[model samples]
Target: MDHAPRAPRRPAAPGSPPGGDERVRGAHPHAEPGAESDPDRAGGFPRPRRLPERQTVRDQVLGALRGALLSGELCPGAVYSAPALAERFGVSATPVREAMQLLAREGAVEAMPNKGFRVAERSSRDMAELAEVRALLEVPVVLRMARTLPAARWEQLRPLADATVAAAAQGDRAVYAESDRAFHRALLELSGNRQLVAVADELHRRAQWPVTEDHGCARPGAAPARGTSARLVTDATQHAALLEALAGGDLAAVESLVRGHVCGT
Candidate 1:
């Protein structure tokens, strides 16, 4: 299906931006500095409540849980209870249960008959399917962007590219994952397809969830390779090269690199 034309995406000029949802949770295992937590206060990586009206307890619980999943605080096999998560976040079990159900719907968590919930486990086939979907959705959009989007727009993504490199160098999985996500998102947003962005984000998140076992990248697991820190450094370099290809309007190179990145990463 063909779409109407719109302005190409303009990446941030230089400085770093928030690492998507990671920034929302503050991404640290501990609470933010000076942030207070009480059993009744309801906190744990939740976004700040606005003054006039605070976020609903359910939203707060959801945000914190999502952050936990992304930050590796919640592992694939870890089983957790609503009451326990509620106590830890200082929220009510009602909200925690509601949030867990939501995550379950997204396949981020699973419900046990007696146990509350466990992080969802992915098989090698599961990860492969996610990568295949991501490639189908993202590669074409990026190819179009490369051919039509102005070169200046691509230059704005330099900071995100740099952040990916730094995060890989530092071996910070959370940072690397989020930075890589951000870079791809920035590219897709240029295509002005909201549905595409939403679907791509879902696949990206699933692909990123860490597996408890050591699974080869080519097999079915998609969390960066087992010794992925070094691999991430190599991948980060490839991101820089991809940006150069996009800027140069090399359609063939853009498509080739995007395929390798979406499928192989």
Candidate 2:
């Protein structure tokens, strides 16, 4: 009998978005088919979708502050004036401070000694290092999933992959990031190892910002320039092939494809 690999342990009930719970650019909300929901545009080009309206001052304050950080509007090492942001948001310093605290938790900003908070800065070296880690950890985890999981798990993840592809085509990095994450975690479930999954979770979350999620752009001569377009085509193609390999139980191919696809070498 071909023994199916059982999940090593119970997996976390897939629930809610990772890290910051609310929707924002580059922040994936509950995984759905609409991360790149704009009506007009080709794939790999993300339409500029408006952020959600905040139902509370706290949400608004956090939303604005987070936006400023991610868009490169706020430079690293620049001390943020909470009072000013509070004023700008038309709220009190309390909410702004709360928002800052939240950003610090996400590693998007660092708390300074006398300067309140500054946007987190990663050097090119840091980026490369993180990318290496992502290549190392995620590719293997995904390959294992491709090699192991049962049909039901693949069924659960297909919509996510499809959604991510759409999100990438539309250039909605946040939604694309989230759906991409969902697909990975769903794949990780095949390992049945909770600890690996948790580590994989944080690893993917950290790399979310700098990824080349431009599936619509990762073509041989058509990849998008800068980070505006996600470099998704290569990864997407590799992933799609891996999925097909999984369906067919091609372990050697999963191993080889994932490494070259993610490492680019």
Candidate 3:
């Protein structure tokens, strides 16, 4: 049978990395057809889209890595090489290495020389300890802020709290984690203590480590188990309740809600 001649390939644009666009578009071999066209459907370490001009490739990879962690795509205690992740993300290894290094510094992963980065594992006790510490630091500060922070300031935080609820409703764990942290960080920032904010942020990141089964096994690429979505929505709803309690000067309600929210009581 006769065949048509193949068209000549166009040269990459000046200053553009070779195969840059194609790599990003072609990375998702398993994605459903037309999934890339809709950002909402591009779950779990999605290909980088056009971001703000200021966002670097490393930043993009870091964000995706965090999302992967939250979604349990990068299971706890598993080692992953930067080059492998680079190919998965359709980016160069340099950005993935830099991003992994940043994650290592953030305590999310540990560098394994001549191997790869291992996702940090947390025991049940470790989670409890983190929760206790968070409660100790955040509950008191939030209570104080409730009394002194202006009503308008509390109102300003409404949008952030709502963002968490929105993310939860969408059943996107990664998005919920980011919005959840944003809500807490914004609330803490009202305390006007940069150091406290920094510490609390780190603790929050640690608290969000992907949970493992009782036998220390991780379910990779699994959907949230039964009741997980409901729990997320319930937890996210508390953000609004917290703001209301704080704004109403209900110290008792604020204490209860903040403790439950922080410690997962």
**Clash count, one per candidate:** 1, 14, 0
**Tens-digit per-residue lDDT, 1-265, candidate 2:** 8999985754433563554344444535443455456464324356677899748777777766644443344556567778867766788888888888887887877787756787666665555676688678766676666655675666656776676677667554554556677777777767888888888777666655442222122222332322344465445555566677777778787777766654544
Which residue pairs collide, candidate 1?
124-220
Preferred candidate (TM-score higher): 2 or 3: 3
For residues 1-265, could you state the per-residue lDDT of candidate 1 as single tens digits?
9989988755543433634223333334456554445443334455657779679989988877876676556667778899988988997899999999999988889998778898877777777788888888888888877778899998998889998999888675666777888988887788898898888887887787655464332222333333367877998888899989999988898888888887775
Residue 222 lDDT, candidate 3, scale 0-100: 62
Model 3: residues with Cα > 4 Å off, grouped in runs: 1-53, 214-227
Scored against the true structure, residue 158 in model 1 reaches a CA lDDT of 89
Tell me the TM-score of model 2. 0.59
Could you tell me every candidate's TM-score relative to the true structure?
A: 0.68, 0.59, 0.74
lDDT of 3 by residue, 1-265 (tens): 9999998878876655667444453446566666767776663345667866798999999999988877767877889998899998999999999999999987889999988899888678888898999999998899998888877889999999888888888776778888899999889989999999999999998888755653223375565322267878999999999888988999999999988888887
Q: In model 2, which runs have C-alpha deviations exceeding 4 angstroms?
A: 1-68, 88-91, 211-226, 233-237, 260-265
